[model samples]
Target chain A: MREAYHDQLGELAEQLASMCGMVGDAMELATKALLDTDLAVAERVISDDAKIDDARARTEEDAYSLLALQAPVATDLRTVLSVIHAAESIERMGDLALHVAKAARRRHPQPVLPEAVRGYFAEMGRIAVDLARKAEQVIRTQDIDLARVLDDEDDAMDDLHRHLFSVIMAKDWEHGVPAAVDITLLGRFYERFGDHAVSVAKRTVFVVTGKMPGYSSDATDL
Target chain B: MREAYHDQLGELAEQLASMCGMVGDAMELATKALLDTDLAVAERVISDDAKIDDARARTEEDAYSLLALQAPVATDLRTVLSVIHAAESIERMGDLALHVAKAARRRHPQPVLPEAVRGYFAEMGRIAVDLARKAEQVIRTQDIDLARVLDDEDDAMDDLHRHLFSVIMAKDWEHGVPAAVDITLLGRFYERFGDHAVSVAKRTVFVVTGKMPGYSSDATDL
Candidate 1:
């Protein structure tokens, strides 16, 4: 029974890593579709959302079955709980991507954003994808080093967010408004994506160290 | 053991209801601050986020303890799961409210919306508060009647959102970009508040009925 339990746990973690990869790829595609005014890719991103929804449902089911069938405890329990939360966050991130894609489809052929705001969006997209990748990395390798770096990764996303706001509010404000709103929503999505990724890392921390991360209310502050 | 289990469940339900009430009040204050342009009240709303954060943490702790201690099954397990997800949606709704309150504070003496835009804002605000209150009703009563109608309630919010967008874009194109970016942000917040409130209602439906309201996802439609 113990061996079976370990095997099940290993399988679930691998599946979770794959889901993160797929969701991250979807987000990258959605971002490109938005920036390049690529209707075909925009349509493709939106059309392919079922992939995300299916993965999300499966992830939730895996966690539930692990809890009910295997009755995971201690580290295993943390993994399941964190999986549930992370799955929800990734699904929502997918939705955000789909949202941007639909908007892109609607406003086809629009010019790319002005430079300052464009930089913010690109940086946000990169950080979001990296955070998702790092989550999978920590999961596969159980790397304490990767877990420790998550906060710094999230901080960078936040810095980009604050800068996007400042640029919008500056003298070039009008130049940034449309791009700013788009960037703001993108930042919110990416920041939140980074946050959920951190939750996975913290769960790793807890599993490896038997300590819940600090902060009484650190849900998605991840 | 069963009686103690019942007692713990009751406590959890009560706490969830309390959290729901706070979220409802947060939505109320968000719109009220907008309508009145009361920066002090908005500041208060932002400052008081800790209360909502505390409630969220307590809800999670209670849910986790209930599951780990009681080892509930079937319907009981669903009940715990519902509480966990509801608290999550509530946390996000609080964050949405904070987003609006923060925007309001930034626009101290909030920029006056056009009369037409104000009317739309009022309509959106009313619908948001109504949906939030209905969430409380479902939590307290487990009223499937009320819970299912959330689709309709959300339709109203969606309608208001669509109407607001038309005005914003049309005015921008015709009259050349009038309202402050802050108002735009406020509108986005209210729209999102309604979305999360509907999410809470959907969770209620799952808890009570054991079915995940299978509204097929087109992702393109989002």
Candidate 2:
């Protein structure tokens, strides 16, 4: 019985790592849909977000059952609790991906991003996908060093977010108000995706080190 | 010992309710700062966000201790878990309010919103604060009926968000791209604030009903 209970706890971590992969795929496809104007791919991303939500629900239920039935204590208790926190952060990453895909769908054939600003988003998308992948590896390995690396990547994402704003506010910006609005929101979605990815890494660190990082919140305004 | 354990659980609920109030006040002050262009008020909101973050950390620590030392099971376990989840949602609410204050600060003295769309934001701010206040009441009372009312309030917020977009996208909109970008992000911050508030209510309902609502995710793209 004890062996099975421990297995369940390990399985919850595996589930969260898998969730990271799911959202990474969603973000990759969503970025493609945005840049390529592929409505079908965008639609697929939008619909598939449900699966991520379901994954979170299942992980939470498993963790809750572990807490209730197994009555895990000490390190085991922290593991169960961290699963719940990590699951919420990963689920939010999926939602950010969904927002990206929906942005692609909103403008359809016209292209959501103007040509001048498209490269910024492409780079942002690359960094976002890489962050999600790294977060998955961090969850699976519990490597604090790798988890800390996510913080640097998040810095890169913030730089890109700030650069995008400079482009919008530049005198050469000819996309007008609507396109600028789209770009602003798209930039925010990617920035927040990075934040949540860092947050997932932070939660993993908490489970391993038994101490939360000094900064609890990951939010910042552009 | 059992009675003390129950009191700790009750205190967790009270802590969450107080968190709701903290964020509610933050949102109110943020709105005031944005509308009035009061840098001092925006500065206060920005600084006070630390208090909300501290509240979340304390609540989570308390909940974690309950899970570790007391090893709460069944309803008590659920209550503890829900405290973790609800605290996260409330913290995000505080972050959203912080975003609003930051937006106001970023464009200090110049006002983030132009004369044309200020009314829309004014209304959005009002609804966001009301939703936060109602969410606090729901957390305290565990009143599912009051919780359901949050959904209606969220719908109202969505309407205001959409209306703000319409005004920004109107043909006569002369606020230019920078202002449009600011309005877009500000609108999104309030919309997300409403989503998190409703999420808090849903978690309260889950603690009472032993079931999560059908709609697991509250995110949607404009």
Candidate 3:
């Protein structure tokens, strides 16, 4: 029974890694769609979200099944629950990517980002993909150290978000209200994408350390 | 042992309902602070979030302890896990409220929402409280009917969110880039608060119906 349970856990981990990869690809494609104004790429990202959703659903079902069948305790219990948590974070990341794609698609051949802030969006996209990839590695290996390092990456995204705001608010700002609205929402999407990756990484750390963050830590603080 | 486990589940439900109330109050106060430029109220909202976090932590710990001690299966397992899920959604609502508070604080004395848009924000705040109250009742009563109705409430929020974007994008929009940015983020925070409430309600529906939402259903669609 124990061997069978461990096998199920191994399967869960594989599903998790796959989810991370799918989310990473979704964000990357969504970014490409935004930067290149490629409707096909944006369509792909929107259509591909179903796969990420399915992956998350499968992971959750497996976790619930394991809990019911194996009734695993202590670290094992935490592992199953953490898998659910991480999958949820990754799913939200996929959703954020989809939002970016929708924004790109909404603009169609016209660029979603203003020319002045495209560079900031590009850097945000790059950081988001990097964090998603790192989240995958952390999940695959359960590397607490790598998971901890995601905080710094998330901080970088925050910095970029702040920079985007500064550009919009600059004295020489040329973009009108519509462009500012797009930039604001796009920056938020990218920032939240990074946030969900950090959330997954933090839960990975919790699963390994068995220490939940204290009440003092804000949800986004993770 | 079964009776004791059932009692624990009942206690968990109470904690979740209380959390709903706390988060609802936080958002209400945060909205007031934002609209009124009341710093003291904003500070209270920020400080009170710790209580919501603590409640969530305690509920999770109890759920974990129940799973380990009782090894609940089938319905019992789903019930405990749903409690945890509802608590998590409520915790996130609290975090969104905290973000609203911080936004209010960041702009101190200067209102976050411009005078022209204050009415729209007021409506959003009113709807948020209404949804939170309904979520609490759903948790307490486990009313699948009530749970299903949250979707419509959530839709109302989405409409408000769309209206906010239109307002921001209107050619007549006079708010500068900074105000626009703040309004955009604030609208998102309120929309997300409604989203989380709907999530909790959907889980409640799932627990009662033993059915999951179809893949085509959007997250906000719930």
Error of 3 at B215 (Å): 10
lDDT of 3 by residue, B1-222 (tens): 989987888888888888999998999999999999999999999899889989998999999999999999997788788877788889989999999999999888788888888998999999998899999998889897887787787788888888888888898888877788788878888998998888887777777777754322234311
Model 3: chain A TM-score against the true structure:
0.94
Going through the candidates in order, what fraction of the true interface contacts does each contain? 0.05, 0.78, 0.59
DockQ of each: 0.29, 0.75, 0.54
Residues B98-185 of candidate 1: C-alpha lDDT, one tens digit per residue:
7766666665674546555778877887887788888888877888888768768777777776666656555353322325345555
lDDT of 2 at B190: 91
lDDT for each residue of candidate 2 in B77-119, tens digit (9 for 90 to 100): 8878888989989998999899899989989989888888878
Those runs of model 1 whose alpha carbons end farther than 4 Å from true positions after fitting are A73-75, A112-116, A172-184, A214-222, B110-116, B172-180, B216-222
Worst 10 residues of 1 chain A by lDDT: A213-222
Question: Per-residue alpha-carbon lDDT of model 3 for A1-222, expressed as tens digits?
Answer: 999998999899889888989989999999999999999999999999889988898898899999999999999998898888888888988998999999899888898877889899889999999999998898789898787677787887888888778889787898787888788878878888887888787777787788754322223321
**Each model's TM-score, in the order given?**
0.89, 0.96, 0.95
Q: Is candidate 1 or candidate 3 better by DockQ?
A: 3
Please list the C-alpha lDDT of all candidates, in the order they appear. Answer: 0.72, 0.89, 0.85
Task: Report how far residue B121 has shifted in candidate 3, in Å.
Answer: 0.8
Better of 2 and 3 by TM-score: 2
